[model samples]
Target: MRRILLGAAMAAMLAAGGVAPAFAQGNPFQPLVYVNDSVVTRYELDQRMRFLQILRAPDGDRASAEQALIDDRLRLFAARQMGIAASDAQIDAGLAEFAGRANMDVEEFTRALAQAGVEQQTFRDFIAAGVVWRELVRQRLVPQVQVSDAELDQEMQRVIETPRITHVALSELIIPAPPGQEAQAMRLAESLVQSVRSEADFAAAARQHSATPSAENGGRLPWAPLENLPPSLRPIILSMQNGQISQPLTVEGAVVLFYLRDSRGTLRPGAKEQVLDYVRFRLASTAEANRIAALSDTCADLFVHARNLPPEQIQRQTLSQGQIPTAEAIRLAVLDDNESTIVSQGGSAEILMLCKRQSALLAGNAQEAPVPVTAEGEEGAAPDPDALPDREQMRGQIFSRKVGQAADNYLAELRANAIIRRP
Candidate 1:
């Protein structure tokens, strides 16, 4: 819930200028509800409703919008007590980060939103409140959250003891079904699935239609491990191939369409494959691409250029051939060390530079190699117990979850104590 709120708030920061027409001076904005001393105006509620629409907020409606606005009021109230608010620089940086997700700059994203009928100030205010709330949560909660070494060991042990499983990349479109609208929702899902022939089409439909928070991200979900998916979904997911879209899946009160983007096995049994280490530089514009093409001589030189780009514009990873996207993988297969290849996706061009390569037996294979692929001197070291991979990521996830839960509970208490009245 906290993450969802943060995403909504961050979306608010996409544009920083513009103003909504104010109520006539004789009458202040008419109050809809009061949160202690703070009153929520009808105008604010209407603005929040539109804001939620842009966020593709799941279960979004006037009621949810009202609750969300009330919660934000509570959050801002708390932030005031803590003296936590976003600075002008922090807000600009947040705007840049949010725009990056859409492969755009602030001006570009704002222009896109304007075309979609969303005002600039709505995003700005949403982001400002969200930024301040995040700081408040971090300052108050993160220091108190801890993951013991034992906890990490237990998680690692679980991974080792569990059987090898496949993970999948997925996109989804969901339609909500009210008590009597089940058949209607199913029909809608069916129609949508039949019409969406390509991934871009599916994403477009999801952006306009899905009743889930992921709709804002074109229904894209992370690489979800099979075991982590619902029991009923496992069989359906297992039967899907890349680019396949599922039939309408009726679950609880929603009709869903899951698009299988990609999938891979964790243990390839007896498979032996050459793994490669590479850096993919995603340039912001063709101009940047031309500049890099002229100046870059070695794969290492890309990092020098990266210093001027946002971190999301660059990717460095080690992956087996199967893990690379088909077209890019084919290009990588022929590239020598320090050689680079270019490809375009979503209007951005990516330059992939091969760094190193090594052969390794997969997890289920009898042969074992400590390192997949690495430069000399980087390999041969015993694993450091203190330097656990994804430790910080795990800590951050856990901390965020705790903060979210704590915030939920705190907000509930605040509502209970506050003199809330429908005016």
Candidate 2:
């Protein structure tokens, strides 16, 4: 990343050399752009110029496109060979379907495509690549994949039932370190943290010192879901009160001093374990692929026999996916470790699962929380009109989420096989 950016910055500097009044310059071919392997060809440069003339790109937009193309070429060269390739028919079908879905007539779609500099053929290739890659992932990778029922149930419970949460947002100004400047950077970081702690108001100090673009917003960062923050940042946030500030945290390349402004988020608050209880068992990594598969297969068998088990037997026998052989593999394979669980009694794989022993208790009446109960008896707090989601919307959210998870897990497998060359 540094190599790419530093090279670009250097290129930008070289490009600036030509800025000495174009009107006063004698006609000469300047070194317009350079890549590691070769300079941009005159023919290529002329083609871009012609494209600019015809397309009427904004000032420096053509240059931006050229630089982007160079970057793309470099990336392609550095990436491993792909076995994934979409067929012509598939690409065509996908394009047609997408255009139709967007409610654009053929001509209108064609015009819109031209405006975006997007060719139908290129779009087709992109879709085809995805189809091919997905197939590759399923074949060479996904067969080895397993999803622990334990993880799945855990996630589903978390999502379907969210905790009410609150947060305080903050922006921080970091002092940058030059090459061989670590000592100086630390000194600056310590000084900055101290000054922010002692002197002026957080907002004032933030505006004066923070290098982040949000300085004008008084160092106030946009509210983010707790999960969106870096894992290291999470505990600190959790430990904070409504309007408290934090000490300096060492982030990569810089020190961060954060001040909490305000936050609102889903807070799990806590739960009374019930019949629907989902337990999470963090697994150990061993004999990855085969072990996980065996665990999964075993869990499936146990789940089939769960109804026959006695109460005590069920509690003792059912194991989470994470507990079994290849437990980590089981977590990765099932793809929804947080939402699913496997349960069984008196089975060998039974104790391997992260079991959610849903106690024989119900949430509504026995230890009732004041929540609205549906006619079919799903207990939840009724929305206060302003807070409620429409029925269709709620359904859509779940569906979209399921679809998204499938896509992500599919991609993750492919990424594991990919060979990335940094240089």
Predicted model with the maximum lDDT: 1
lDDT of 2 by residue, 161-197 (tens): 5544544465555555444453455445445545555
Model 1: lDDT equals: 0.70
lDDT values for all models: 0.70, 0.45
TM-score of each: 0.46, 0.32
TM-score computed on alpha carbons, candidate 1: 0.46
Q: List per-candidate RMSD values in Å.
A: 23.2, 16.0
Candidate 2's C-alpha lDDT? 0.45
Q: What is the C-alpha lDDT profile of model 1 across 1-423, one tens digit per residue?
A: 233333323333333222232223333378988887798887777677755554444535789888988887888888888888789888888888876665668897677667544667766777787888888878886677777765554454343333344789999988887666664665567578668888888899999989999999999999988879988779788777789888676567777899998887653432345677888898866566767857877777888888966888888888888898897788888988777776766667788889865443322222222453466656665543222235456556656677788767777877787777896
The model with the greatest TM-score is 1
